[model samples]
Target: MTFPSGGRVPEPYGQSSGANLADILERVLDKGLVIAGDIRINLLDIELLTIKLRLIVASVDKAKEMGIDWWETDPALSSRAHRDELARENAELRAHLAELERGRGQEDPSLERGRVSEEPS
Candidate 1:
């Protein structure tokens, strides 16, 4: 099946054939098992992923040209901005708790959504 993102939605478990099953099993069980290597799994609960490799390699000039500030703005990453954000978040949490204590029924703040836009292109 084709997903909305136009990526192939592979057959669900037990729907695909023997070759597909073999491929899946090999990929899961024999990862890093090439050239005299071996892979081990618990098969109890899901094997806790030991390490996740996330490689993002770009030429410095190209990255600078694109204004791609790697790790600086990502929330999951630990940076000074993240720490500052945590501090701000703590302050906001305190403010929100104070507001709740003061008993303002939390209806989400609404902005003007009356206007509709016409497609230009």
Candidate 2:
């Protein structure tokens, strides 16, 4: 199609001859962009619900290039070492909690009978 200026417009989309969709996508991935928004549900000026969302779209190489590869070592991502460390930390916390409860004279009777539950920590 032709514009009022007598210049031909690119078909399908407004992309000019100097730029293509692939170039746009490559730039976006190479230089990460964050799309963040907040949604709130308010009733009579009292917010009943608030949700915040943040999204980043990038290629794996780009993500790693930006030092954003947390999933590689995250416990939830099935990293055995991280999972073990988390398990140890959780056990320590539970033991600390049990000690505190005992100090307060609140002990589970089953614990005294060597019948502790199989629950973690």
Counting clashing residue pairs in each candidate, in order, gives: 0, 0
lDDT against the true structure, per candidate, is 0.61, 0.82
Distance from true location, Cα of 7 in model 1, Å: 58
RMSD of 2: 10.5
lDDT (Cα, tens digit) per residue for candidate 2, span 10-115: 5665646447777988898988888999999999999999999999998889899888887777777757868787899999999999999878565657675554
lDDT of 1: 0.61
Q: Give candidates' CA RMSD values in order.
A: 26.1, 10.5
Pairs of colliding residues, candidate 1: none
The number of clashing residue pairs in model 2 is 0
Candidate 1's displacement at residue 38, Å, is 29
Candidate 1 per-residue lDDT, tens place, 1-121, comes to 7888999977777775888877776564433222333344656787754544444344445455557576667767757878888999999999999988766444433422222223343
Any runs in candidate 1 off by more than 4 Å, and if so which?
1-56, 104-121
Best by lDDT: 2
